[model samples]
Target: MTYQNPKNLASIKEISARLDDPNLVILDCTSTVIPADSGSGFAVADGRGAFEAGHIPGAQFVDLERDLSTPSDHLLFTLPSAEQFGNALNRLGIGAESRVILYSTGQPGWAARVWLMLRAFGFENAAVLNGGWKAWTNAGLPVETGAAKARPAASKPFSWTYRPGFFVASDEVVARTEDEALVNALGADSFRGEAPIAYGRPGRIPGSVNVPTSSLVDPDTGLYLSQQQIEKIFADAGVKPDAPLIAYCGAGVAASNVVFARTLSGAGTRSVVYDGSLLDWSSDPDRPLVTG
Candidate 1:
């Protein structure tokens, strides 16, 4: 098998030139954090509102909670059925040969989540837009207002043929964490129990090391860290090259960032994202959470 680096990320300039490519499909996955009434954790910002206001030309808006996730009474953005996800993409005109480019206006992690979702489902042509919306607007690229028309969903039911080894579970967290490095992709504050921000509980899973995905991107540029820089960040977090690593975060979104970064760093083959993350762990009071 051939190796591909930066497998989940792409730059605006690169995608800009290929906007007219028939095989290309671009999606906007912008989402922000909001406050909850109970003050338990957090809520997601309205991606539809943001997309309606402005977006890359010809880019259809994809909702993390709606288009990409399943309807659940308890969870917020759990992964949708493979058929559900495929139909959503099918409606966007994505096909067997389509090269998907995903972006976001807020955190790059949001875009990464979609990229990871597509990747886990055996789709290899998907990638997150580097620097996302901020970089696009800052670069003076054309931004359009209002919604773009989407292609109709396929008449045939989208079948789900899952590709394993892309995700990890809570029980697996306990079973394999000793042998594999568990990286918590949340912020350092949460790592220290100072700001558990979003979750039913306050703290983190036992044996998980903190490697906040935010550290791997430039705040001003919104671009990912360089290879050298990514190496240092992982090193500081006790992550090693060629090691088996599982990334997790609040509700499993930010973990995508780490997963993508690992791919860029040549360790992706042994990396996986814990899909349920803190949302699943924090639910069971029995799950151990340690604070600094």
Candidate 2:
């Protein structure tokens, strides 16, 4: 039912059963990519549009930009403040006891954002739909179209509570750079500034390992790999799961996808996301940076 730790994961059937329960809230976190060619843009749009055309009867759409992230900043989906987040949750009809199952049309990036945010606010019952929406739809479950009313009410009041073992800031990663055990969740190209795709400057933090976040998922299904599979991925990258990991992507969003995978590996590891990621890391001239 409720999962407080990362190690716990549910199958499509189990999550589906929970979705059938009226109390559980299924959130479709399929993101609308700005550039549209990043990865699964068209598919994500189709899934969401299809959801609007027909979803799991009561599922709600959680737009990555509008519902989960702030509109002011362009660096990426950086987290919102506690009050702002509470307001968003309230508008979504989320309460303290709400059981959320976050599913994305793409990989875990979008779902992971909501999961991390829920954990950050100390909501203990949130779970990410394993394999995301694709898995459910592939199973040939029922679908619905058109917007539905918010059941009995419009909004639910909720208060923000700080959650430990949930999130990490950029300075924390910088502090751990000297430890020699930390792994960087960015890609080889961006880590070396060879790609230079980010809005700010490129290049990764000093002494960080290059473990691209995309490596954790199945390209076709957009589902996370098995625990053993992920272990091998990390091992192939020369990373030890037992060590403390600080997952950081361009701006902390993508890295959370990696964190979700690592959590399912049962390594007794805690992965803290570097919230500022490359955006804040590159902006400051004083911070140490390294390139391959």
Candidate 3:
């Protein structure tokens, strides 16, 4: 049976049934967080160790920091150039016809991060695995150990089409007009400058409303809430239904989760992720941040 492309989120059952489809490409996009030696904030580490230990059968691993992000002296996961991203996809054997499934070990944010990256690069056939690795294991799905077998190169190099507006920089965020809604995806504590961990500075972009990524998912299942529930969360948070949205978190990773949930709730066309997010925003003393 042929694999059917999911709109944006796929379930474990959907993937388990398509294990034999040649056109299917499953990616483990896990990245773990470690406490920085300074002991103030956190640092990110590649999940190669976790992936090497075990992962979904036939799933290759994609290191968000090393494989997908552009190397930057100051930034963490800045989006790479179109050509660079295209080359990476080609190396993964992702072709125009491939249906990609992305999942992470912990939060779905890691998977959503890659999903947004794929969409920004104009690849529309990718989907995030709902509930991710945890849900899969809970269901007793088959898993494999050790490194992934090298993927066969795509028949032709991936043709990249850059889609503007899916990812925006700090300048666009700074230039946001009154009509635009700036949404913070960080937890309420961080947003309110009460968290022990601060990204440069606690607090959020001035005038941004909170729609914490945590609120978008079921605490027990690790799966996203129903579409109606998500939409209500947005509305309750004062997110305008029709206004353009700029989503951000400490860095850009969690913001992708918010963007993904918003999209799933039928309000994604007007949403964009601030790629640099608060990491860039808070670095500049000149940029204003508001605390409650």
Candidate 4:
């Protein structure tokens, strides 16, 4: 039986059952993410090579860097416009009536980023394949080797209507200081400045609390912790369920997982990822950063 879990998660079994749905659009968001400490000067590694090598049946490759981000002079993690994103979706055979499922080979953050992006653009009928590629293979699911393929018929029309307010900037974070709680989606070391190697600077936004993406997921399985476990993790950090939150990390990638977790943690909390993150925050001489 085909089924979708809360927070837009699709079990491998659910997707396997609906492998023949006409309007089902599956995207392989598999990416090699090099962290800030990699010294490569780029946070994201090219994932096309992996996608082109082998992918799930009826899956298309979604290039996060080239397709989702626009060229900018400054080194910031920014998103593309509605038109640009729409065109990318169309090229992948996605349309208004499609149900998109995204999955990745690495951490859930990569898949979550794509899901969060789709929601920001007003398409909420998308899910991340829980447990990702590993889970599928572990479960002995069949796989196809070769180039990417789109599930929807080529003749299907594609479109996207933009919806705003899925992300926050440094200015807005400052403006909403008193209202929204800020969560640092980084390891405890990075959150506490001990892992300065992971970021440009050694501190965090003054009031942000630590909620490492690693904690919300199981490293061995790539599956998320139960909703109760996730909520307790946040609640233990003093994050209020009813209040809004902002998630940030070294380059804003891990923050996506936190936002996705909040999406799954039930409706009382709404979280937005700050794309620029601490890299943008610490770059400004005037912004304050704190460390223990």
Candidate 5:
């Protein structure tokens, strides 16, 4: 089956042409933990507030927490129910045949979560917008401000469905901790003996590769590197696209980033995510924690 271009954002000119099509639905995925005044490290910054302030004319707001994801200390954006997903799209005015173009406020990290979830749920027409809000606004495109009332269609067609991924259960993770091939997408500090920010346990999945998902994007451009660059990045991190790779981060958010990238690589290779990731594994006293 032909999946949507994993590198959709690389060609800005081509993607821009589809913006005006009637069958398309653009989503402003900018999300932040704190406002500008608070001086947080990095945040999507009032995503809904920003949407209300200004956004692409036809774009809709997909709140990461409230709308697209479920609340859980073990994981963020753990795929919602198919019915819930269908309702979300319908409420956002997304149609069955609509091509979803997701963009963020210069940060593709958070937005990538939605892109992966939508695709995993069998919505193949979805793609992430390149350069995110910065690209659109920089091009001097038409922008709309203020909240638009949802025009609930009397009978909206619901076609979104969830296709279970090969995600490994925490028990499997615990069992395979000594595999020496599991890849930890979290920070280096966590991979070592040092304690991590999100979990009580310090080390990583035994012998796991370390390639923080944040490294996938160009810091300045907010765009993913080319295919060659992606392959090289993974290779340097000891991640072989051909291997039976397992990706995990503090929660599953970062691991999803790697899944999106590897799927785009198209090498007939597959990687599974440890959905609970470190969150569930670390909290349990029985799960082994390895330190360098």
Candidate 6:
């Protein structure tokens, strides 16, 4: 089956060929998340060290938590204001005519998050590198080491157009209409509250359907499943083929993968990521959560 939105994904071959395109801006959006020492949740770590060790030639590293997200004392990966995001893009030399490709050394979710952010900010020329760094290396592609070279400025300034509905708040999730589906992108163990680790609470948002991001990719290849396979996964998860979906996870990172997967599957469905997700929901005792 053909992808519903083919432009959202880039193949390793396409990326390899475009390595020297003046308008191409490749970003390594890798961020490692390790289990917190306290043993309850996860902590975000900069992927610069890994990128410095080796990366796609001419590709710059993006610290998602540091470069793109807003500063939050309690939450991780909060959405940055349009101005802040625009400035970050400027520094990276992205412009109106630029083609941005995002990839991660770890989970594809890290790269998807940045892709979602760019989409939300009205940048339409960006795509996520399928299979990310794993596929690139497994294919024996050339790698570069050392810090990223300073990016030359874009010929034209990046125009910011704030789009609504790409990200929703907790209240929006709470007030979701019946036509909408609330999907949890965390693993089944977390969805069932059986996992030893949790963001804040051990349960899922009340009435959420499970569609873990991990299920969207081929385990062995680190590439997304075929379009037909992904569509079936969503249908099996109780999501109506045409229903709008509100996807959420620990701190809204994994949910982006869900959103991206839905697009890649050619499901032609509208999906939005809950910005705060479980981290925001569980912090408030008044909110309700359910566990199997």
The most accurate candidate by lDDT is: 6
| TM value for model 1 | 0.93
Candidate 6 lowest-lDDT run of ten: 262-271
lDDT of 4 at 291: 84
RMSD of 4: 2.7
Residue 166 error for model 3, in Å? 0.5
Local distance difference test, each candidate: 0.80, 0.68, 0.86, 0.80, 0.68, 0.90
Predicted candidate 4 versus true structure: per-residue lDDT over 1-292, tens digit per residue:
1222384888898999998897888888866756465542445676888877777888888887778877665444478898999888888888777889999886788899999999888888899898999898888998887877544444655556666678888888888756688899989888888773545578789888899988987788988888878878989988887879989997667899898887886734468889878777877888888887
After the best TM-score superposition of candidate 4, give how far the Cα of residue 170 lies from its true spot, in angstroms.
Answer: 0.9
CA RMSD of all predictions: 2.7, 4.2, 2.8, 2.7, 4.2, 1.1
lDDT of 3 by residue, 1-292 (tens): 1122238888889999999887899999999878677756788889988898999998998888888888876678889888888888787889978999999987788999999999998898899898998899999999899999888987655679788979999899989999898999989988998877778877888989999988988888888888778888999998877878999998799999998988887774489999878878888999998898
Would you list the rank order by lDDT, best first? 6, 3, 1, 4, 5, 2
Using all chains and alpha carbons, the TM-scores for the candidates as numbered come to 0.93, 0.82, 0.95, 0.91, 0.82, 0.98
Best-to-worst order by TM-score is 6, 3, 1, 4, 2, 5
Q: Candidate 6 — what's its lDDT?
A: 0.90
Candidate 6 residue lDDT tens string, 1-292: 2687889999999999989898999999988878877879888889999999999999998898998999987788989999989989899889988999999976789999999999999998899998999999999999999999988899899888779978999999989998899999999999999886787889998879999999998887788888888989999999988899999999888999999999877664589999989998998999998999
Model 5 misplacement above 4 A: 1-11, 33-46, 148-156, 175-181, 193-196
- What lDDT tens digits, residue by residue, belong to model 1 across residues 152-184? 443442344567787878877888845588999
Our model 3 lands, by Cα RMSD against the true structure, at 2.8
- lDDT accuracy of residue 166 in candidate 5: 48
Model 2: how far residue 247 lies from native, Å: 1.1
